[model samples]
Target: MTEHRPHSATTAMGNRHDYLPAAGRDALLPTYDLLTRTLGVPRVHQRLIDQADLRDDHKILEVGCGTGNLTIMARRSRPAAEVTGADPDPRALSRAERKAHGLPGIRFDRAYGQELPYGDGEFDRALSSLMLHHLDDDVKAPMAAEILRVLRPGGRLHLVDVGGPMTPADGPAARLTLRGHHVAGNLGDNIPRLLREAGFDCTEVATQRHRAMGRVTYYRATRPD
Candidate 1:
């Protein structure tokens, strides 16, 4: 059953993308953070890190470290580990770098998921939260291959994004609002098989949630030795 509330206002422009296209990233950063909090991002990031299982010596990379929330968390969790956050957005990267000040082994750089700046087998684990869906259908496989290429044999890629449809219980308004978001696209595609074809061995998948996002999925895939 839908949680009872005053009917969601402005249900027509229900998602951040609608706002983003009009006002741009500078205006929407806080809005983005607010929605992330609504979806319980701290809890989400915690679970994501737990699933990552970082080793003491692990060299980790976050492919789309947008506001650096997860990147910061990963660095804090393993102070000795080398945690690097690379993103294509200069504005976001600058903000993340500032927020990550004084953290040893945490660096931010401008880079895209498709053509990462790192050399092969340099990292023990890679993370991409809510980022894969940005790539077009033809690009996603190559992006996955790029991620696989940067990791060492057996290196793990920990990811989370939208999944299949919402449960039958989900309200129509909820579904309509999320239509253009990353989750919807993922649910419609054969992501695991794409990863497998990209040379990753799909390890695990499970349904999880964010406060703002109704239904998302977690995935773990590793580069085979």
Candidate 2:
């Protein structure tokens, strides 16, 4: 398993300019594909995919789809399902679009997790992976509400993000990382409260070791029927 390193100080600073030079971006296309493709197949993603119970008639939305790693995997997992990948990063979207080009029944869009452009009750399932830690509750709470608004009654929302007990040993490192970018609020402690406030019934919550030193936590909930 690849270790999940903290983003560079520049990326941590949230400076879009710090990402990479255009030439560097061009160089990373192949690397991005390899990483996302491999990561998307792991047990964690498979669990979320199973929970989604995708069907031919389902309209699935993937927020912060990044380079469409999970988007393509989702399509492959449920070939007949309609899948859309949304991300605020144009560069990432471009890469995802290219990867999705020859694949039918899949699309990419420019959108933020906090503000989705789709209609009300337009989707059967909404998903996000590895994205929440980058946002605070002000952004994530409203985004969670928006996910519910667009989901059909009884539809599900599957989210995977970083949340765990930050030990005293981790405290200094975690704080250093936070100086550059906001880690997703600790959903491990807050997800249940947030779900109830959003009017969704929490169906499941679990944590698993992701790689060597990091953990992946998930929350699966449903809109009331």
Top lDDT model: 1
lDDT of 2 at 157: 87
Error of 2 at 216 (Å): 1.0
**TM accuracy, model 1:** 0.82
Model 2 agreement with the true structure over 134-178: per-residue lDDT tens digits: 654466677788888989999888887665543334455444543
Alpha-carbon RMSD, candidate 2: 6.8
- Would you list the C-alpha lDDT of every candidate in the order shown? 0.72, 0.69
**Consecutive 10-residue window with the lowest summed lDDT within model 1:** 1-10
Error of 2 at 55 (Å): 1.7
Q: How many times do residue backbones clash in model 1? A: 3
Instruction: For candidate 2, list the clashing residue pairs, or say none.
Output: 12-180, 133-183, 133-184
TM-scores, one per candidate: 0.82, 0.77
Model 2 bad stretches (over 4 Å): 1-11, 17-42, 164-184
lDDT of 1 by residue, 1-225 (tens): 012111121112333321111113456665666667776767777888999999769999998788788999998999899998976556676778888888889898776666677899999999988766555555576678889999999999998875545542455534654667444557734567778899998854666543356666778999999
